[model samples]
Target chain A: MAERAYIMPIALRLWHWTNALLMILLIISGASLHFTDPVIPLIRFDIARTIHNVSGIGVSVLYIFFAVWNSATGSWRQYIPELKGLKANLDRQNYYVFVGQLKGDAPHVVPTPEQKFNAMQQLTYIGVMYIAMPVVIVTGLAFFYPELAPAQLFGFDGLLPIAVLHYVAGFGLTMFLLGHLYMGTTGTTVAGGFRMMITGWHDEHDEKPENEQP
Target chain B: MAAIKTVIWAAIGLVLLTTSAIAQIERKPIAPEDLKNIQDSNAKCLECHSEGGFDTLNREGVDKDKLRDHLVDLGVYEGSNHGRVECKACHVKGFEEFPHAADDKKQINWCDECHTRKFLRIEMQFDESVHAKEGIKEKFTCSTCHDPHVFQAAKYMNSPRDVVRQDNDFCLSCHGSDQSFEQVSKEARPDLVENHEWLPNRPLHWNAVRCVECHTPVSKKVMSHEILPAEKAEKRCVACHSADSTLRLRLYKHMVSEERSRVGFVNSMILNEAYVIGATRNVYLDLALGIFAAVVVFIIVLHSILRIIAAWVRSRRNG
Candidate 1:
């Protein structure tokens, strides 16, 4: 029997979709700017620059809201990996993804309100949100306002270091997105994770706990 | 015997007439109409100004280096862009007589007479320059930097490397030496290389860009001729090295059309002319990025393929 639970909130769902769309826009526009003579004419260069800057600002605002909402709702804890069960959880998830899923075995963990992300997802999210995103944002702003960047930082003069850092961080975020997209389809159904994101409800094949049984 | 004597006298008279005509053609001052057709006026001027005619020592016994300076070398002047322009075109008031009058010698040639129409914008910039602002117009004429007799457009030079070398030389002619600056201006001269020690590869930077590019405020077409004070000069590399570099906006503004400015992040296509250290895109970096992205996608695709094959094999075994 499948038990349906309301895990994602309406506000969180809106933020997620908005953030996803903005990321796509930013990536496309950013790529257009970085590659002077891009093969695909996604958009005009000037338009791309304008859109990229606007989308970057939007992402920054959304990120701030996300931080505040996560803190307020205690959902921030979901991203912090539990050190005690981390090794076991990672091993089980890896085994299910690499081996057991191919043999049609059930995944080790089910989605819960308090524990949304798995151990691996939690660790990866932490790196992306805390390290990569911040690096990209800081360096992007540095590029935008070159006067603020130090003339010489760690032997690099001017905006050279900022540009390099921004590229590296953006590249990392792209890699993370690729992994995230692939993993989204690894749930019970091909579109199961996507459906949950849209509806704020997920169906699991686990029984209701005795304490919460009605 | 009488017929022979008459023939000899006539021959002598004819020879004298031919010699006088040749002297008239060679020594005659170029008329306003004739000036337009003359190929080499500097050579005509050098006919009298060269070697024996003009003395280095003047009537007052002062070594008038300034007066002797007007003397042109036919060899050098012949090779210049200005070689074709008649001397009367620039030295308008002078040279109606054998010795030019005092007022004629003192007459200032206005560059604006011709330059105003072709380079009106640059002329306007020059009018607003610090030299003009300070009323040092007499001391800082066009001839100060550009020797009118031997000047050529830097772009038309043999190579880009020569262009850079010549452009820097134009500035260094005055600023490079303390004595030159002292002779020209009342201001104390600063050591050019020492003042620019903050910039890495100072000589390389000097070679790559014009001194006015950084020292003057940005303009529409030409770089502003108004040299800023040392403290006011642009120190940040990003001012010219960034996507919205002022160098492009001012120096290469024509290259950035309305259509192109609207199309890309960088306003101008001329950015591809040279590798702009950090501002311009790198092909090697792009290739690396492409390889990295492909590897990431390949890993995910390979893993998915393995999972699919494994699932199919298991299902077949079960069946």
Candidate 2:
């Protein structure tokens, strides 16, 4: 791949931060609702519902905008993983994180606009957007209208299965957040990814070309 | 701009006039249609309750949690048999206008208004029965058996399967356990389980001998302005005791209690309460966990498939 530079587009920047912040908020409030503590009720468990509801709207709206921008601008194609070198690149990234960087390696394959995301990032984001979010929303609807649903809640005659599905979706979202937090630290510096998400500008690494054509 | 301002001011004044009329939630005959308009009124009940209330519990932030609290309140309400009665049926003259300043529920008398026959029956029966007639301190009111307002059957556990799942918890509030009934059954007659083998021979299966089998259902249907005397209460004892020895032994070896049921029997009632509640609660927790797990597994599988497809397409394009 040729040396290239691609300043993160403004729309992409906004969507990224909005999605990241909203996901964090969801995990916090969702955790609090399912498992609350005795002390420090910044807001009561009742308000966890409000937080979950409003933040859910925020995340979903941003997701719609992000999807539209990706499709319209044809940037969604960038997520396509290199089938042949996927294992090699993933291993290279892992080695850099673990011990290779300490022993002074060239960090395997160089980062490029064509392959902006590592294999893991592509996989995680795809699942969160397409699968996990819809499950959470549907389960939430189930909890809200258990009686008016396929059946009444107090009776086991029907709708018992929906209730169980609701909890599994909740726990799944919890697991997603935990893994997401661990991956967040893998940027160029100690707090590089955190800084980039906040300001929408990762510190320009000297070795890699900054200018990349779309 | 000047003419538009005048029209806008007039509209604002007219809106307030309409709202003031709607605020009187005590509007009588609170039909289903009225509830929609009531909810749409945009009146914040929390505005006053959170700051000013006779009881601090109904104060600020009260309305925020009121929805969940309503369900919890239903539990307490059922325990008192007030569970059967509707709140507004006794509250204000109308549901919308339910007076916020007082305890409207307890103020209205239940026996004279709703359960006159059962009330009169108690008065007539007590004279010849077990209690010391004059000095019986524990007064049994109309609600002793029937809660005229909120009276409702447990719809969830109204089935045999639901009852069996919960075992005895559903009706434990009124009935005792099987073990408790065993002691009473021994006193009445031995061969407790073995004798009652068929459908009719179950534990605590007392035959209806004296208790009126066919009576009009007593709901809260009060009618005033009639000078005619109300129907008299009836106590037809010996429905089973006097039905002749041969018939009595066929149903029971003779444990008929025209006076009162054998002691340690109320425990059996509580056991039925357990069955319904236990069945419903277990169903909820189980179903909640199951779907929750399935959704997760489904998402994971989908994610893997999508990942493989995306990678394959990319490699083909490159080739």
Candidate 3:
């Protein structure tokens, strides 16, 4: 038997794809700008600068809109994991991915409309969306309009710390994206998670594990 | 006897008047032929002036200091931008005599005579400089900072380090040396190193960045000549230490076009020429991040491969 639940909304799907596109553009353009070389130019310097600036602004604006919309619709709850038994739940999820999945065991937790993300996804999403995105956005804007950055920070130029922070946060997001994409394939089917995002419905089979982990 | 004395006095007054009138007249641009003729006439001037020898007729009043000031190194002058300029063009015609006329020293060659239109913007900038202040005007002139005999333009130089050294040398020639300062101002010289003690790595800053970077107001469109006083100099390290440093607008503005053409990392290009503390990139940091990302990708790929293999094995066993 299979059970279906409405997971992603139309608005959320639109925002997700738009944000993904912008992030990809920003990463490519930012890499071009950072490691610019005469012979191995991925993008023209002027063009890369333009793309980075435009995509940065686009993502920043989109994030603000998504934040307000999520708050208003009370959908923000999906990203907030229950603090009670959090460590145990996280441990169980980690066990399923690391050990149980290889032994052909079923997952202990499944997604629903009320709790759309698992414990790990909730924590990772909160960190990336709330912390890393804001840091990178603020730092990116500082680089774009440098005059706004504080003239000094702890005896160093303010931009130096800001540049370092932006690099770290951007790097974290890039790593997270790779992991997130790979994790998407670990659902009921290889393409099940991706199809769920597109169609706004999640389908999970109630099949018992052939070799259950005692 | 009284009539003869009066006549001698009148003739001297008439000669002074004629010399003053000649000094007041501004010379117009001359033809190439005339300029060559005037330059050729400088052979006699160079004979005494080159390599710093004494004036045989006026050796009694001449001291070592005065002789040293008057001496022009022939090689240096020939290499200067003003190498071909006629000596008489600056010093009025009557200087050929054994005892040079008194007014000849005061007969200033206003730089505008030949450099009229080309330097209009620079002339305007000079007008606003601290050196051009009312009381300071009499103490300084173009020659105070720029020794026409040995000056070479910064733009013509290939290396930016050489340009920075040359430009700072112009300021330090007066500010750093007491002997040079005494030639112009009566005020006691301030110690250059002591005044900049508050700055970290003072020598590096002095050599890498130009004195004008701090001493002059920033201007992106053109080089600023409004030299601020020591009290007014930029105190904020962020002014140059920041990624969007004011150095980009002033000192590095000239290199921007070439940097763009090469499409190298902006800070890397700056690092190639000069190492600014916070403005440049860290190779170690970049390498570490690159390795970290590569490891993350490897883990993701490995995990997915193992999971796929497990699923295939389970399906085969169930069937």
Candidate 4:
């Protein structure tokens, strides 16, 4: 029998869908704002700005709830990368996705609650949360303030650090997101992970191929 | 013998008049001084032109340089409506010699020589126009608006007068009545012109978004909100929006756009106000929004820090 554990939680699934939908909206509006000059996709500048801010605020609320739940349940540990033999595991992961999977090698290890993400996946998700998301939100706020809000908050001097942090985070987020989408598709089945994301469970009864290749 | 003597005297008089006419003459060209032997004196030319050559007087002691430069200064005259006429043709000699006296009749023009019917028609119209009559403002001569010598006046002033008047503000200068000029500018027309006394028609006025949110596209980083003035914002959102305009300016925030106070966002308002403060100009939007943003960030950051601390404390307790 294929091994399984307490897979994705209902609460986690709710958060995931909400988060994804909001992000799609944010991306549409954000891309509209980013590619402002060419005048394709997004029709109006002000409309783009408004949509972006609203999506940001929505994400803000959703993240607050997610953070609270994660902290409470102690499930955030799924993201903390293991320190021992991390590099070799990362190498195995690289090989599995890039080469070994095509040669029918078994996965390095089956996913468990404690070892849900591989070293690379753990690092990438952690990087996004700790660095990327915060920075983008901060930058969006800075723009709003510069465009429409007041000047004297924690003082003019504090805003510069905030602005710089935002840009750095935005760039990091870009790199992480690009990599995440590319690698996310390479799970056990072509749509295995995506199916789990939608239905909250992977099928348990598929027979192992005598010469299994990804 | 007596008849022949009379004829001789008349002939002598005719010769004298001809030489005098030739003495005080100006042609299409000035006297050609191509040769060193010729003397082209400006004072003599100004004598008849500045004063009355038809009378006995001309301008007194005109400087040679000033007279020579008059050609450049008065060069526009060649392009004028009276380009064909010689100066002396109009400054016709009265019944006088070179040192003749002035009579008002000497300055008169022979209107019959041009268009007889049009001249009389204009004279009747002139009596009706205030300038032609007793009123100083209404009285405008044919030469008042038009430069008889040079028609270049319109060329230098950017565009024709009508187009300048067609400007958003320029048209409103005279047309504004019930509405404040600020409202007039913001509104497309007429409706903004209507809002001076009354607030806008509530439902119609309520739908429009704030002006700064849409119209001003200059990047916020470089936006110069340094010139706020005492008069109030001409570009404010409510100006163009009235129930009356055919296209209809929209107001109010929709599902996505959250427009706020217009003046607070508009750089034009800031610049006008900063004008009085002289050197000190500050944009509050950058800082205020900055602060608001920081507070939100700080809260999230504080939560994250607390979470980390609580986790450490719990682990310590367990250990």
The best candidate by lDDT is 3
Clashing pairs in 3: none
For residues A165-211, could you state the per-residue lDDT of candidate 2 as single tens digits?
54556566666765565445544443766665555554545556322
User: CAPRI verdict on model 1?
Assistant: incorrect
| Candidate 4 per-residue lDDT over residues A10-43, each given as its tens digit | 8778888887777767766654543343324353
Worst 10 residues of 2 chain B by lDDT: B221-230
**Per-residue lDDT of B114-173 in model 3, one digit per residue for the tens?**
777746877677777777763566776677777888886654455566768888989988
| lDDT tens digits by residue: candidate 1, B1-319 | 9999999988776345322210111222456665456655555566556554465333443344655766776555655666656677778766745467568856656677778764576656677766666566678767777787767564334333445566567778878888887777788777776788877546556755677777789766555667776777887665665555665654344344421321122432333233343245545566788899999899889989987887789779999
Task: By DockQ, rank the candidates, best first.
Answer: 3, 1, 2, 4
Give per-model TM-scores: 0.53, 0.40, 0.54, 0.40
By DockQ, who's the top model here? 3
How many residue pairs of model 1 clash at the backbone? 6
lDDT of each: 0.67, 0.43, 0.72, 0.44
Better of 2 and 3 by TM-score: 3
DockQ of 3: 0.10
The DockQ score of candidate 4 comes to 0.01
Q: For model 3, how does the per-residue alpha-carbon lDDT over A1-214 read when each residue is reduced to its tens digit?
A: 7768787889888888899999999989777766655445677555776798899999999999978987998978878888887898788889988988788776666776666777888899999999999999998887765545564443223456678789889989998888888888888778988998899887874654221111
- Interface DockQ per candidate: 0.08, 0.02, 0.10, 0.01
Backbone clash count for every predicted candidate, in the order shown? 6, 62, 0, 43
The Cα error of candidate 3 at residue A125, in Å, is: 0.8
